[model samples]
Structure formats: structure tokens, C-alpha cells
Target: MNPARALIVDLPGPDLTLEEGRFLARHSFGGVCLFARNITTPERTARLVRDLRDALGHDALVATDQEGGAVLRRLDVPHPPTPMGLGALRDPEAAREAGAVAARGLLDLGINWNFAPSLDVNVNPGNPVIGERSFGSDPALVAELGVAWALGSEAAGVMSAVKHFPGHGDTQVDSHLDLPTVNKSREALEACEWLPFRAAVRAGVGSVMTAHILYPALDGERPATLSPAVLTGLLRGEWGYDGVVVTDAMDMRAIADRYPGGVGAPLTLTAGADAVLVCGHGELTPHAEHLNAVERALRDGTLAEDRLQEALTRLASAARRFPGTPRPYTAAERERDGAQVRAWARASVTRVGQVPRLSPDAEVLLLTPDQPGVGGPYGDSLGGDELAATLRAYFPRLRHANYSPTDARAARALLDEFPGAPALLATPTRWNLTPVQKELAGLLPARGGIHLALWNPEHARALPLPALVSYGFRPAHLAAVAQALITGEAPGVLPLAAPEVV
Candidate 1:
């Protein structure tokens, strides 16, 4: 295998380095997975993508993680409610629109492949990586929403890779950190976690990304990324997933921690993965090593010729299928799409109890998470910025106090200053509150306004207050929550299942 054509690596910055440019030329590794560092502005991004395509040809697989709401490489793009948030809406139109909007934005930046519509059913609240990233806990809901999102994205001229195949939702441990074992039988897998993948396959998803987690029921020792039983037997043999099978970042600890020095290359390819995402994190050394390992195995007869040919054929087929192109939305289309997203946000923000009615001049205290510059669910850049500005716009006399949820004393002090004054408190997460935050929530006064749970709706049930779930952290999401609180017209049901606390 040619290292240049075989590897999908990352550049050091927005502009390609001399080595990167030379390496990414035709017959080389032109497949570049973008990250935050590679993005600057729309013009710069389009230019960069154009340059790469010019060098690598139109079929070059240029990608980025533009999964709406948080996991984004380009902040300039319009991000709709996260998959979990869309799950709360459970509207196929909304889900499809969200995907289309995100894909259109990415395509404007000349990114043809979006690793999005994460199909993992979010069953484990403690799952660190795939919580809000996933659609939701329910299998049917996830399947419906995920497939809709994928189709919409594909229609927008961007290849939507429904990811973390066979599900990465139930595991508590993050595969990015270490190996997470999902101790479920094949029957159990078929019933819950695997449903979305099944739906995606049936719907003719162009690509399926393998998860890093180990399922003992499928294979004894190997994770899904390196297991033939999971990738070849189940995905290819049984389900007939003829599309490309990409491994989820071989540099991730789930693969890297076990097979040091690019050992996973031979294992992953032989296990039936069509593409190995090893070079995206900006380390070319390991990528070179992986290529060398693959070449050595091929020459030594350790890795069979049939497996290599299968992977190459799949990659070629994918290139023919997805000729990377920019699909810009018209100005009117952009505005209409934006309106649709805002409408969906309004529709998805759910109210659980009494939504406090504070006057425009009422001295209402607003307690929000102090997320500083953090992105994703923490901040849509949500914390203390968009949320404060939106709520403040509604309630001019709003007394906003930002608090670190992890630091109880700091938040407690903020509460002390408020002194039982009716306050709008928002706690954002896809899981339960931090013990400290939970304690703080309990200590709040009875009429502590409304508990606005952005991503973690269940936490509102635990707080000693009525709750409203925005199910998102985008500015529009915050605006929707404020609208609901102001007008008392919120209409959304929490997507997750469980009894509400008294």
C-alpha cells in the first residue's frame, strides 16, 4: 500500500506545511480530517480545501467533525441542537433540517465529509464521550432521527458517516481514554445498541465508523475497531454493509494503548476496516509507522492480499461515490434554514413545572454555569455569554451570576448574595449533576424561579425548583428558553425515560 494514498492525516495548521502539501498531492494521502486549528475564516477554509482538492483531485476525502450543537471544527457554521437535543424534539423534519443545515455550512467551507449524526443510542448517562453527541437513549428514536439526519446531510452534497457502529452509547468509560468493555450478549446488542446501525445500513448509509469499545459477547479480547467478528462477521457478512468501514481514530487510547508503534494497522485492515483514521490528530510519525507496519505485514504474508484488496477497493468505491464538492446555499435558503433551526429550538425547549413570570423590570437573579471559553455542551459558547445576553435582553433588571458547578462554595456564595430572590438557574450536562452542584441545587430556595436544564434535563427533577429543558446550548436555544419563561408557551417532552422526581 502507498503510504501517501493510504493515510488520512492532518496538517499542522490552516495552511499546509511543505511536507503536508507534498505528501497530500495526487497518489498521496490527500484525505485530510480538519480540526479547530485548521479553521480560520470562511474564505481561508474554502481556499485551503480548494488547494487540497486541486492537488489531490476532486475525489479527495476532506472531512471534519461538524456534528451540530457542539462537536464542530468550524464555529462560523450554523449549529443546530445537538443529537440529544433533537432527540427531545423527536421530529424527523427537525432532525433532517439540522443535518442539512450543518452539512451545507461545512460544504461552504469545502468539506465534503461530515462525521456526524452519531447513531450511538445514549443509554449510559455516565458515558463521557458520546452523551449529548448521541441522539438519545431510546433505540427507535435514535434510529429514526439518526437516519433522517444522515439522509438530509447526503442530500446536501456532503457524505454523512453515521458513526460509532454497533453503538458506543452504553459504555461509561470513554474509548478516547481507554478500552471500554460493553458486557452485553449479541441478542442484547441486536435489541438496543445495534438498532441505529441496522437502520443506517438499511437506509444505505455511505459509511459506518467502527467504535473502539470491546464487547465481550462479540469478541473476547479485541475492541470493535480491531475485531473481525464485529467488523467482518457482523457488519459485512451478516448485515451486508457494503459501504466503507472507517476505524475511529487509531491514535485513540482504545487502540494505541494496546498495540504500540502502529501495530493496529495490520489488525484493523485485516478485521475489514476500509480506512484507518490514524493521522488526523497531527502526528505523522505514527502514521508513517502504521503504513510501514501494513506494508511489512503484506510482504510477510501475515496480512492476506485479499483483505488489502478489499480495503483498497472500498476506498476507491467511496471516492467514486463522494467527489468532494462545495454546495453553497443561496442567501434565501440560508435565512430559511436559520429560521427552521430557531423554530426547532423553540419547539424542543420543554417545561416541566411552573415557569416563573418575571417582569421586564423585575429584579430577577440569573444563575448560569461559568464556562469561560469552553465549547461544546459546556458553552454553545453557552455559559454566561449567549445565555446571559438573551435572558438579559428579556429581563433588563436581570441579576446574572456565573458559577463553577464543580466548586460548591463559590456557587453557594453566589446564592448567598441572591438571598432567596427568585432566580433562573441553568445546569448543562447530559448526565446527572456533579455531587457539588446537586448539593447546591438542593440548597436553593423553594421559589428559586425555574431550573433551566440545557442538555441534562433529568437534573432538573433533582433540583428544588420547576424545570425547563432547552435540550441545547446554542444562542437560539437560550433565546427559546427565555421566550418560554417569558410567554409560558414551551411545548416539549424530555426525550429520556424515567420517573420524574416529586
Candidate 2:
């Protein structure tokens, strides 16, 4: 009854196989979310969506976590820089333009719902998960840019979901690892954490995803996912958010570890969420079992029918708002959006430190970490090979080394051999440094040496060095950083939270 509540499934990419589409149709799931693994090209992605819709005979909610920058999920298609990179421009108009470009790209690939424009106010620079993904450290800046991005997405006819509601910015631990707890008082949350979510609600964001975080001050024993104080009391009652409230992936360690009895989906739904996400099979089986239990509870009159009806209504309203249609991007539009994203990326790059020029015969080593999971292949130069090529065009004698964690010692030995030369360390923000790399960083001359932390700025903060440079590490950002480094010009302002000197 009522479509058995809505569920969003994650696909490898835009291109779905016949078997995958059938599996989706058979399950009668409400929607699907795309990642880079499923996308190889725009045309192929659009075709896959079309095929799925035809097979399903119902408008499936096709969505993507296309937040741009380092969080970009679809590499086969072009999209703009991440929200933080756009925020770096410090221009609302630029942020809007980048948002429009991303919206256009998603729409072209037949993605209607964009789980993006993260409204999380990243006040904590050491936040591993949300560093470059967040708009900025300041709540006001995040609200302004987030609103612009939301409006842009709506304008392009793509439904936008501002997330992780309540807020996930200030926590030190990643929800992927364990449940993060926010001990800040209610007043503090309203002033600092809730600012951007409130702004998004005012701007008419279509959906808000709940975090797996626990706010002890809000509700003592339960995480936000299972806390009525958070979802019903704060979001729906106080803020009066009428949009769909979807829970973050239940498969994440935060919820899984706590809810060992597999009560997440039911608890989340009962707690006021419109939909609960069962991200992977490990969580899906339990979620399905929970749904059956919920049905049983309804039969026994333990779960109120009205509560289920309310959730159904929200899901139906959201689905009705998004009329599924194929929105293809022309070549000219693709180029235009690509250019806009690159311009924003260029503006977002920031140089945190400077290094003295090395001798003409010295080598400038570039080390990149390996890509995890089943997504795109890790680039030879930390996804900045093109930028490196551009650098070499001008400085042909510049030597570079690209190494994974396994070769950390070799990479460090190479750097040691060239001690007379100025060293440059380039690695993805996602890459965790090996012990050898850490030791090498200690050995390098602090003043004239440069450590360029590409990708996540949070990673840079962890390094035990005094002078560290952070480039948000998108393709355009890489180009911007390379140019800035060569020209001795800083790209943007230092992060609000700078690394402390040891």
C-alpha cells in the first residue's frame, strides 16, 4: 500500500545494465542514486536512464551526489567545482553560476534530484568528511552561497536536497567510521550549526537529509536519526520544514554500530523521517526485515497508520514535483558549463605557503595516493597530471615523482637524495600519509620547503609541518594552484582554521 514507502538505491553509475534495471524494477524501489562508477559519458548515461524509465514504466527518482570539487561522483560527465571552491570566489553570482553548471550537467545525464549544495557550516577545519565539500567556515557565507546554489538547481529544473540536516560540520569524527556526537547546547546549535539549514529551509529546499550524529543536548540517549527531539521537535516543529526529511545512509558505521538490532529504518521513519536510506545490501536486508516488522506492527496497531500516511504523502509530493523527462545537454551548453566550473575552480585555489626556488638541476617530486573503492582510477599525478603538464610546458627541467603509499619510502629516499633542491609534496586529500612520508616531512627544511595538500584541507591540518599549502584539488583547482605556485602569486585567502605550528 502507498508504494511500500519510498527507497533510494545507489547504482554504480549513470549506465545501468539490463540486469541492474530489472533488479531495480523488480524491487519497485522509489529511486536510484548515481556515483562515478556508473558514468563514463553523458550520452551513455542519458541512454541508461531512459532505458530504466522505460522498463520500470514509472518515473524513478534518478539522483546523484554531484557536489562538485573533490566530492564529484560522476567523472564521465562534466560538472563545476565543489561548493567550497565556489565559495572561495566570495561572490554569490559566481556560486550561482557554478550551481547552474552542475545542475545542467546532472539534468543532461537524466539526474533529477541532486543531493548537494551541502549547507553544512564547516566551522571545524579538521572535519575530515566535509572540508572541501562545505561552502566555507562561516555560516553566513555558507547560507548565501548555499541559497544561490539551491536556487540555481531549482531554476535548472533539478530538485535539490540540502543536507545533513541539523548539521554535520563541527564534528571531528567521520560518520562513516562511527557516530559523531555534538555536545553543543541548543542555543549554540541555533546560532552556529543550524544557521545554514534554516537558510536553506527559507530558500525552499525540496528535501533535507538527517545526520547520523547525536546531539546530546537535544536528546540525551538517541542519535539524530532516532531522536524525535531532532527530527520532529527541531526540524518539523520549530523550523516548520515541510519538505521531505530523508535519513543519511543507514549503512554507515554511525547507525549500524549503534542499532545492532537493525532498528534504524523503522526508528528513523517513526522519528519523523519521510524516507530511510538502506545504502548497501548489508543494510538493505535488515531494512527490508524492519519494513516487514513495521507492517506487522501496523497490523497489531502498534504503529499508527496516520504516521505511515504522513510519510507517504511527503514522498508523493516530492515525486509529483519532479516530472521525469529527458533533459539533454547540447555540446555548446556542455562547453559553457565546463568553462564556468573551471573559472570558479580557478578562483577557489588557495596558496598557504611559499618555497624558495630550487637549483636548476633539482627535482620537484609529486606524490599521489591511490583511489579507494570502485570509482574512477587514481590519476598518475593526483588527478593533476594535466596541470603538471602545463607547468612542464614552461619549466621543462622540473622533475616530478608520482608514488602511492606502498612506495612512500622510495619516494622519501628520492627526496632525501635531492636535499640540496627545494622539495614539493603533492598528494590527494584522501591519501593518508605513510610513516615514512611523515618522517620525510620532518627531515625537510621547514622554511623554504613546500607541502601542497591537494583535495581535502582537513588532511593538511593533520600534518606536523609549520608551512603547509592547500589546494582543493579539482582539475581546475590543480591548474590554478600550479599557475599560482610558478608565478609566486597566492590564489585565495588562508583557511579560517590554519594549522598550528608544532
Best by lDDT: 1
Worst 10-residue stretch by lDDT in candidate 2? 372-381
The lDDT per prediction is 0.77, 0.68
RMSD of 2: 3.6
What does the lDDT come to for candidate 2? 0.68
Over the stretch 88-166, how does candidate 1's per-residue lDDT look in tens digits?
A: 7888888887888988888787787788879998777666777668778889999999999999888877888898987
Candidate 2 has which clashing residue pairs, if any?
Answer: 12-38, 13-38, 14-38, 69-82
TM per prediction:
0.93, 0.87
lDDT of 2 at 396: 65
Query: Which candidate's TM-score is highest?
Result: 1
